[model samples]
Target: MASRSDAEAAANAATGRPRVAVFRPDDERLESAVSLLSDLGVEPVPDPMLAVEPTGETPRENADYVVLTSKTGAELAAEAGWEPGASTVCAIGPATSASMEAVGYAVDLVPDEYTSSGLVETLESEADLDGASVEVARSDHGSPVLLDGLSAAGADVHETVLYRLVRPPESGDAVDLAASGDLDAACFTSSLTVEHFFEAATERGTTDAVAVGLDRAVVGAIGEPTRETLTAFGIDADVVASEATFDALARETVAAVDR
Candidate 1:
């Protein structure tokens, strides 16, 4: 395994093209960012700012409801062997529900608000959690929001770290896109993506067209976490949906740009 300190150096050396910035660096997200950029004819210089890696550990025993919030959770559950019937499955939104369903698990409920608050509300409103055992599947880099909420609502709540999100190596061509000023708008799906965008943006020293493009060009995030990332960068998010689904994200983008 390459050392963390030098990973960026190697990645930069390998980066032959000047990329536009994208937040969060991981295999699945990276692919999605590129696909969107290509579809838009933006041809982004691909660089991720955050790296979320799965731990692959199963949830605590007696897990009766498995909670999936991000694609990371879904991907981890895909290989972590948490069976559906073992617990009533809950997804934060439809895209997650679809991912879970594609993996053969039937989702029990999805929130209407599509944020962490929304998930809690959905569970409280629809689920008879008077004595249910629940486990939230997620990366290490999360808050205690879900667990606290579920526990407060009389559900036996357990939390498991299915992955870890770390900052991607910085200081390199990924820098060129944000710094050298040779690119257009970027895209993000998570707050991590925003982290990545700012890291490169700060390095570039000017937020002008690049930042504007991200804000103006059709910002599409999968859910609240992703949208918050865009907002944190001091760029106004043009599209904010009530749900957390790629369908919503994609459809919102097409509408934002078309209008």
Candidate 2:
């Protein structure tokens, strides 16, 4: 049986479209990514690395501020009928803010940099966090930077695990493609995605080969944290998108392949 990558490679060979790996969760995100890549004139290998498992938890309502990190978190909070009440609603980025807004939650704050550190810095500069109660609702794999930074600023921080991002069991197709040097580029949207990609490669006993193959292909990371993860794995990213959005990451990655 021919692999998906083999069929994609064969099709792309004639169209001259670059084969770019996208590791978004298997949902509307993956569909959107595939559409975007197709519009960008690339053959997107839709290999979903992350699967969202909702924790059936919501942010505490009594906090001074409520922080939501991802669109998924915001949607889940909305579905859980969690209300901000007197708390200031903060989103980690534009997408999160939009999600909150769509759910009728007023977005009180969004960091200019759209990262954990950036949100911490923004909150410190804008709000009075001294002895304030802050509730952070996000994924289980969230960075500790936000909590640490908020605590250091004298805020009592509490975290609610809204979801767990686990790697899908059958997510190593892109790893096989990468190991065979068949991919033209890859867009890594998060640090976990990078870690999961390597985990898949390692599981297939193709870690070294995948690394070597990646050396020949363009690699793009969504932000500094993701790039740092790739660096930890000894994988040098050819492009680090200026913005942390998937749109930015995909565009930058596809452009790198064109170059």
Candidate 3:
């Protein structure tokens, strides 16, 4: 009898080309997904399951600090024409910090790790959050980790929900490929994207199919948060990027498939 790994190896040898599904919203990261998979000599399947719409609300005045967790939030908030004034700006990652800087806002701090928990740890140790007013800009679907953490540290946290993430009419081609067991791997960038992907699979009556497909496919997660989300759905990530960046995730995905 052939072992599971042996079967997978035989399948890969038969196909000659690995098919990797890019599971995320259509945004700046899409280009990286396509290009990275191509560079690894894999077939790239673009599966955009979510869309972000900016909210029109402006940032509040008298904030002591401004917190941005994602580049999308930073971009949308900047487009809304809100000034950060003399408030210290904090970004979750370098990408978000760059976005904030591009809009003429000086970033005062960035977490060593690009995560909500990392942000909380950095702020708790470095800044005096007691009774300070902190403004957070992000999507409605964003996790409450940052807000809850800041609030627990005695900061009066205000939220400027800059965008709402909405599901598309249908799961893209990648979901179908995943359901049919035709995909060699799939990369999930965010927890929301992982949630929406399964929801779409259920709606299309491909839940079982996807479950079976995932057993044979290399699952790649962008970070610890996304990997945790995948685990919640009974799927284990075979590869998790060291950094929470698209390029890192793509490289990890290719490495996972190659292994």
Tell me, by lDDT, which candidate is best. 2
Candidate number that wins on lDDT, 1 or 3: 3
Q: Write the per-residue lDDT of candidate 2 for residues 120-186, one digit (tens) a residue.
A: 9999999999999999999999998899999999999999999999998888877988999888899
Worst 10 residues of 3 by lDDT: 1-10
TM-score of each: 0.70, 0.96, 0.90
Residue runs of model 3 more than 4 Å from their true location after superposition: 1-15
The runs of at least 3 residues in candidate 1 whose Cα sits more than 4 Å from the true structure, single-residue gaps closed, are 1-21, 24-29, 40-42, 170-175, 179-183, 200-233, 250-259
Q: What is the C-alpha RMSD of each candidate to the true structure, in Å?
A: 6.0, 2.0, 6.1
Which one wins by TM-score: 1 or 3?
Answer: 3
Q: Mind sharing the TM-score for model 2?
A: 0.96
- Residues forming the 10-long window of minimal summed lDDT in candidate 2: 1-10
Residue 174 accuracy (lDDT) in model 1: 45
| Residue range 1-259, candidate 3, lDDT tens digits | 1112445545654767888888666766676677788888887777777787777876676699888877777777777777788888899999889888887778999999888889989999999999999998788976789899999999999988878888777554666777878889988989988888898888889988988898799999988889999999889999999988877888888888988
Q: Backbone clash tally for model 3? A: 0
